[model samples]
Target: MKLKLTLVLTIVSLSLFAQTKYSNEFMNIGVDAAALGMSNAVSSTTSDVNAGYWNPSGLINVEDNQLALMHSSYFANIANYDYAAFAMPIDDRSTIGISLIRFAVDDILDTTQLIDDQGNVNYDRISLFSTADYGFTFSYARKLPVQGLNYGINAKVIRRVIGDFANSWGFGFDAGIQFQTENNWKFGIMARDITTTFNSWSYDEESFARIQNAIEGQNQELPESSEITIPKLQIGVSKSYLFHYDYSFKTALDLNVRFEQNNDIISTSFASINPALGFEFGYVDMIFLRTGVGNFQNELQIDNSESLSFQPSFGVGFKYKGIHVDYAFTDIGDQSVALYSNVFSLKLDFSAFR
Candidate 1:
């Protein structure tokens, strides 16, 4: 039974265009409009509540309690992603935050192949179902005794559901550190899924039995549980320059690496290690413009002849009093299909209102 299920999954995975090794890939999708706009190169440059997702240690830069909300249409409207976060300073030296991210697809056809007693196709039974993925994150950061350094950690719970068919539960943890130089240079390193996050899937046993009975001579049982791991390490650096008293520019770069094991073989490919670049220009801390490029997967491209694949992002932001609004346009590139994503975010500073 296990072998049968494994064979089916291997075939399906081969049929898919994406060649990702990890499950719950949505977790890596940048959350806030500002970060996504910057192509997720904010690991070292983030200073808002959104920092909880990018680099939690950056939360040390948040001076006031903040609430952030974001929504985006992904994959040309095929799916939707939403994010929310709240960060509050426990003291001048410590900060705590919580964040939620959800990705969902609606109205998917659930089909079953019905067969007659004589092994002839009776018909196709179809119904509607939906699929969703969710992650809840809790974060904490504190300034290190070493003056210019801060350390942070995140505990996350993951859940994935496919209508009434199957469900998965996962737990993961992340750790990060940030250093700020007196000259305004910021460096960050984050270990994502440091404990090797695992998802244990449980299928509908009754439904499986029914399907098996429906097909003559098919008596395979469903596997009780299957597990997959997610893990990665990322490092970044950023610098902000003040061209004038009221104008400044910030540039950031990030390098991501992951280690994976297949059949007792461990490997790391250059194509698997991604690099990101981002730039942001601000005027009097009120108006902002940003652009970024990253997510290179040339090595992973099934078609070696295909051009390198990368996404470019651009965004604008406005800030007034304690309210901030941001908009970002992300190009998903033409990888078998032309896809694009749009993100919008709002942020509130409670201290400013008070």
Candidate 2:
């Protein structure tokens, strides 16, 4: 009976928690609807404040100060995700940006374990709490001495809180470069968490100790420690093909790879390459339709089964005057679990105001 109870609790923990080898997993989720809509293939073609998150060097393409906001519902209303960013040009060759992202779940049932003198279980003691994550970024980009080349960097701070039980703070930095050709082709590379971010965690020791003791006896080690996040690199290319009367098609592709210690997902110093492809069709750069597919990996094993494997995304956007509205839906595989998300975004271009 004891063995069976342990197995059940383990299964419940795996199902309720997200499993990741790195810290601050929430930050790994894409921020803007426009980017996610393109399956995160905009590393090279990002042209607005969202560039701060994708590729800061792309901020050079913004003609004026821009503000971008996005909101998404994930996993059938299990959580709320939001993002906001602002970008401003300092001169013809320099730009600055600021961004904030938050992900949270509220009013979770916190249950208490109770037993009477006869070891009878009690189920009436349940409370509620919240879990949240926040990220703040400041960025700067400058056109290099060579025309058509740009460089940028970001400083980020992250915070995570869990229902008064534990909290963590982390810091990281990212760098990127972009090169554009006369023929409207663009190439970009970004290195995220280059210094390898570190998260220092603190917990309500007494409470957690008691819980741990009850769950795994007094000999088991409790959860406590600082974690180091690994770095990731992404490379991308984009091009626009023009047809008749300002009609055009924009296409982009990106490859992302992570560098970390030997682990289940990453067995070598460098392993696992994910590819993304996206296309946008537009008339006069106003009305647009987009589709993208990505998250190609061997681990999940692409199939028509109920497993949550690779995700395909679709999006649409419209540009009018100085405002842009965008929407994207991601078909997260595993129909059995019904996991999917919808994202909406709005952008305001200040160039018209100027």
Candidate 3:
């Protein structure tokens, strides 16, 4: 059963177009539980290390050296994920950040060599392999002279490995900006792959020949060596309100714009938009509760009817001094198509020790 599943995943991965619709998708999984709980609403209000992934411009709000870490499991524990990031104020007007992320399915059984060339069934030929993807990002943020305005840029590197059988190296750049109004309203914009990223793939011919017959007629030759990633944009707006002194409320909205028409809620010739909405309640800046809804899609029914569906996420956070802990119940895909996972993250402020 496991072997069959692995084969399916491998086939689907290799069958995509050179200029795919979803490229470097692992970056969209999000880093912080707090942000995921809000469906990545923090693009406008992010203030910590995780902002390196959400919107680098927000990193300018980091008051001190900060570090963050996160872990989660997916596909019924068949894959594991880890994320880490660090950010520091370079000066009064500039900040720098670095982040690393990894996702992998380990210990997959390789059955390509299960049968010998002499038509002999060899039970000991089965071996284990893994498929993994990694991303490293370096971010820089600068507060512009314009009041309440900040800008940021990111240089990203991507690495993917399939148990030594195949590998790829990719590079991309991202840019972002954030602005605040005197009245507390915030706005942000993030552009990913601003220059169009590309991945150069290479394969081991020896290993490649072993599974050339995974499908009846497919895999007859090597795949294209290059994969291009088009640009994507996210625009966000947010506001926070205080109740008396301790209780607080915040709401955020984001519009994700893809340069292609798809099953998004709003589609046009030039772009498709997916809107996300999030809400949070806070107490004394120490405890927080959050909820969000997003991932709108038009699903076709058996009767050829269209139905709208969305994913909802929930999370809680606790903070003491500068140490923060957050947990989120979220799904990478729509709830109907994938299992929900529990995610946890930690953030620590080095200045708190001083």
Judging by lDDT against the true structure, name the best candidate: 3
lDDT of 1 by residue, 140-197 (tens): 9999999789999999999977667677798989999999999999999988888877
RMSD of 2: 4.5
Report model 2's TM-score to 2 decimal places.
0.86
* lDDT, candidate 3, 171-210, per-residue tens: 9999999999999999999999999888898988888777
TM-score of each: 0.84, 0.86, 0.96
Q: Which of 1 and 2 is the better model by TM-score? A: 2
RMSD of each: 5.4, 4.5, 1.5
> Which candidate model has the greater lDDT, 2 or 3?
3
Better of 2 and 3 by TM-score: 3
- Judge candidate 1 against the unseen true structure and give its global Cα lDDT, from 0 to 1: 0.78
Q: How do the residues 213-308 of candidate 2 rate in per-residue lDDT, one tens digit apiece?
A: 454543244354577778888899999998987899989999878765332222466565777899998989898889888775434335743322
Look at candidate 3 and give me any clashing residue pairs. none
